[model samples]
Target: MPRNRATASPLFVPRKATRTQQRVARAEFAKARTKARAAQAPSRRREHEGADPELQPSYPASGRPGPASARGGRLRLPKHRMTTAVAGGAYPFLAEAGLGAEGIFIGRDLHAEGSFCYDPFALYNSGRIEGFTNPNAILCGVIGMGKSALAKSIATRAIAHGYKIYVPSDPKGEWTGLAEALGGQTIALGPGLPGKLNPLDAPGRPTGVSEEDWTNEVRKRRLLLLASLAATVLKRDLLPMEHTGLDVALDLVVADAEATETVPLLGDIAHVLGNPERLDAALGDQAGGLGRAADDLAHAFRRLVHGDLSGMFDAPSTVAFDPAAPMLSIDLSRLGSSGDDTALVLAMTCASAWMEAALADPAGGRRWVIYDEAWRIMRHVGLLERMQQQFKLSRGLGIANLVILHRLSDLLSAGDAGSRGRVLAEGLLADCSTRIIYRQEPDQVQVSMSLLGLTGVEAQAIGALTRGRGLWKVAGLSFIVQHLLHPREKPLYDTDFRMTA
Candidate 1:
């Protein structure tokens, strides 16, 4: 039946193969496929001949080319060699980010490897500091340690930023040349000099102030100036009676000036204090013993008009104060060498009052009221009180008062222990949130540390700071900076000209 079916349908049928036969067929198929792949390998290699060497497949080599040898077994990284200090500094986690770059370019922050900048007004307005409401500063360093140079750099640099400087009292006249160079005015005052300043002179009034307010301000300034002058000369505070006498004399002098339409001078106040009838007529029954009580004050003022301190401040100011000037420096060098510290103090007081009048103008822009040789002025009660007032009103007045001193000891020497002078002197430092300390002597380390609240590292660093380097503390942050000076500023700010010469 099968043979008949194959012949009839012409069909074919297949049977299952044995295991040995199946294996032989599979091996033959694998051999054919392998031959096909081998034939394509040469062509694929030729196509990839121009490919990047790095992109090519990598294979394990006999030895890796590194510091370790094949005999060493594993690859090893080269060991780094450095001192502990160097290694510590190399770690990014141990470094400071530094004060964000804003403000006047002061110098370089040695630690942060960045520019150090500072501007009190700018910092305050920007809220870079917390709870610091005043734009005041203290720059303390030993003489010849570049404190003055740094101050000069700040002032000179700030001028370009539209800031005006008022050096109320330059004891050494160091700022006179700088003022002139900056296209500012410098008023020189001394014995036998033509320069005269009247502290009682009326200040430029702010716009929108009432006449009554203006009159009251002038009266107040005059009274304070007279009292301060008397106190400075007397080296003791005026008694209540003396104050009353001064008030009476000032009132009479002001009244006469109002009627005469002429400014009153120190002599007029002295003249009125010496004449009891004149004061009695002006003050009526309220002038009891005022004239006699004012005798000491009058005599004290007489020294300004007729004594060694005469020819300056007894009459009207010969040099006009141009507040619009870039800078104003009152040169007291002539009196500075007179061996009479009182003369220098008096001159500074008068100059300050005269400039204050111009500063009273609300239109008067921001200014830097530098108190160079601050130690010399702080010893005087009158000047110290004036500085305290200035510090309190710094924000409202749009001014920054820079108090420069030779050492912290200068502050300690301000007055006897627990005296008002001492309290006020310390108060000055307290008001100034920005403290710059240059190289200090070893003995000053304790005082500087306690006063400034510096860390042991900072305290020790302060003693070892080299020239032009300073420790800057602002708000709660601190930096050790190296001040960079412009070549042109060197001659202008050099305090060692005499030594060099």
Candidate 2:
């Protein structure tokens, strides 16, 4: 009975859409699907562009979760996929955990700041980075950044560890305290002057005191100084005196200088001898500029040996050469000159002294030379390649070299930027296996940081690092760390300081 009453109540009840209307709705729905597909298919519209997830905008806090947030803020990442990649732990932690941070460990201390910490291994342990395996260490930075202090620190530590150290002192009186502070002996040797010997001086009988001996020492110093200057001017390494006709030419100049007693520029004879081929070429030929330069070098030496070149050797300079020393620091402050000349003289003297030392010891354990402000000597010494060659053969001779420079452009000045010469330089760096890169400017920082293939976070940390702080890349791992500054080395905060500048 209720159904019968309701049968006529719904005249206006809606009917199903007509076929045409339904078809229109379907068409609209299909159009919308196509639009959605176009919006979603990003790769279809763009060519040549990479899909970088990092470039994607972060979702609103209300919209999505980040990896960190999704992971509940667990900062420790999982083990690196490769066996060689470092795992999470302190420097010493790796070794203790049996994972081994043997190469170079860039890790954090409790304070959260970064630091470089190496393991202590036996002296004969070739795997250990200690003991100057390369026989070279460069400590370079602008004035006041503790360059000297660092030298003192390394020198002191090396000495305490029973390594001999030779210091070429400056007038700043930095090394006078070194002998006492480090327990090594220091003997000052200038062209001819002998001052107080610090306790750090290597022990040996007076080699000799004959007039001939003194004359030879003085002549060696003069020749070294002259050769350094000539090499700088020629922009190439000079042939050693033994193999060329240059010895006679040098003798002539020496005799002339001794008679007139005046050091003359080798360039003065350029007209007499047009630029000859390099040393190798000169050796192949009987006549050329090489011969003329040799003659001029001898003349200059003669003048220097007598009293003609008086003030040239009078910079209040002194160098300490000893195979027993673990380190050698050439102090230029006492030379009374801070210009290129002073740097060249000191570099030449040090190079000659080092050569002599190496020759004296056919089997020294391992010798290292650290040229701090490399550009200073290199600006006029033209010894960059020579220095690098020494580094190449150094491991064979138990010698290692650490060359420090403020900029890459310094190497460019020596030769063509494209000249694979840098490849050799890079090879030397590659062999280093351990590298510490400090804070750098935009240009250098970009290139330097790029080398390690750093991630967004690591690159950011490196870019924001402050003075005495840097990224350490050793073997393959890289991390930012704060380095310990030496007390004796000046604060590297000067206007032109290497790190902050």
Candidate 3:
């Protein structure tokens, strides 16, 4: 301590702060700060109250991660385990509640991994599904995707539920076996086939309709059938006078047949049309061009009478419709292959008219009108208009129509966009409350998505669906369903037997 430099003055040297002194100072500082905050609280509160919501600073609960973020960072949940029943309640998004147990058990729901069941009538009556307005359904898929099997299965199973099944036009004759197996009737018509169907045969009157009303309704139906036939044969729409000629001829034929106690025939109408004097005389003062206008109509009806389609639909029906039969399909496979669908179309028109007339009876009970291979008929506008009328009246007629198509785009083939045929096709689609989609071609996915309003996830799911698996959209809801076929049903529904053989 060599020269202990003059000892630093105690006054100039700083002394260490005492613990007691530090505590006292801190207490005073805290008191001053608390007082200042208390004075500012009222002003801050007023500012917040007066501020506009849009101008207020925001802290969203979810968004890009940042200091203001609701902490969307990597969230590590604790490894807490619970029973599935309990977990279902904790995490509702994982497991779903399914459609209840009612109606026919169709298949398995891929989402809930539970059994899937569907019955248009049941769904319609339950009022469970919102926006479900009708009992009609549309089944669309590429061939060999089990769409036909699904349809046949539905028809087979529905019979057990006390429902009737009607296949209006079976061009391929595939349903004949099922019809015969189920004790249903199958009428096969072709040249030299002896099976004849008079499209004009009147169905039994429904319970509530009066005799006069029923008679008028039959007349209207007959006129519509004739018009559709003539249009199909002539390859064009009938002119106004041609229509009047048909109208007059139908009245005359119906009157003579009713008087003679015999059913009307196509030949009778054609004969009445070929004679201009008869049509002209029938029109009275308006007969100036009725007979001439009917000349084309006479030739058109001639094709169904004395032409290549002779003896088919031109005479009295040989088979009476048995409505009580569990299933009824008109087997038209015997129709000659004339290198065109014309003969098939004409036959289908006649068969459909006959069956539809019987179905119009309100007391016919709940039934299914399945138009298998309906794509062929979609190309014809007259046929589409007729089918559209049936679609609109399905609910009131106490029936459901299951329109089977190879693909949704088949409807587009009916005509170009916005054509009359296209409008009718779209109308048919709109009338259906349920749409079942089997696996579609890659090109058809976008079309299906647009037509059915499918989401990105649904669109992806449908593209990968296996055979027998379909996406059933009931009302606005969706389900990935795998249609299960019973072992016994496999043989009956086996369309591959020809190849397997």
- By TM-score, the better pick of 1 and 3 is 3
lDDT of 3 by residue, 1-501 (tens): 322211222122223546555555556656766788689768766766866888755532234334445464577688987774575466453343455788788888877688988788888888888899999999988889998889998999899998999998888899999989989989888899989899999999889899999999999999999999999888887888888888999999988998999988999999999998887787899645564788899899899999889999898899999878999998888887988788888888898899889898878889999999888888988878878889888888878899988889999998999989999999989999999998888889999999889888778877888999988888877788899999988998888988963
User: How much does candidate 2 score in TM-score?
Assistant: 0.52
Off by over 4 Å in 2: 1-115, 119-151, 166-176, 185-229, 233-243, 248-295, 298-328, 342-362, 418-431, 447-460, 485-501
Clashes of each: 0, 39, 0
Query: Cα miss at 304, model 3 (Å)?
Result: 0.3
Tens-digit per-residue lDDT, 1-501, candidate 1: 453232233222224545555555556656766788689768767766998988865532434433354575576799989764474457532234455566678898887677888888888888846756678999998888888888888899999989999988988889988988999988888877788787777877788999999989878887888888899898888999888878878877777888999888888888887887776676677635455777788789899888888778878778777877999888888874556588888887888888877787756888899988888977787888888887887888899999999887788787897998899989988899888999889999999998888888889899999999999888676788999998999889877878873
Q: Write the per-residue lDDT of candidate 2 for residues 325-406, one digit (tens) a residue.
A: 4544444443344343644353345434444333334355544444555554344423544465555665565544445555
Worst 10 residues of 3 by lDDT: 4-13
Candidates' lDDT values, in order?
A: 0.81, 0.44, 0.85
Better of 2 and 3 by TM-score: 3
User: Which candidate has the highest lDDT of all?
Assistant: 3
Clashing pairs in 1: none
Give the higher-lDDT candidate: 1 or 2.
1
Candidate 1 is scored at a TM of: 0.80
Model 1 residue runs over 4 Å out of place are: 1-96, 336-340
- Displacement of residue 482 (Cα, Å) in model 1 is 1.0
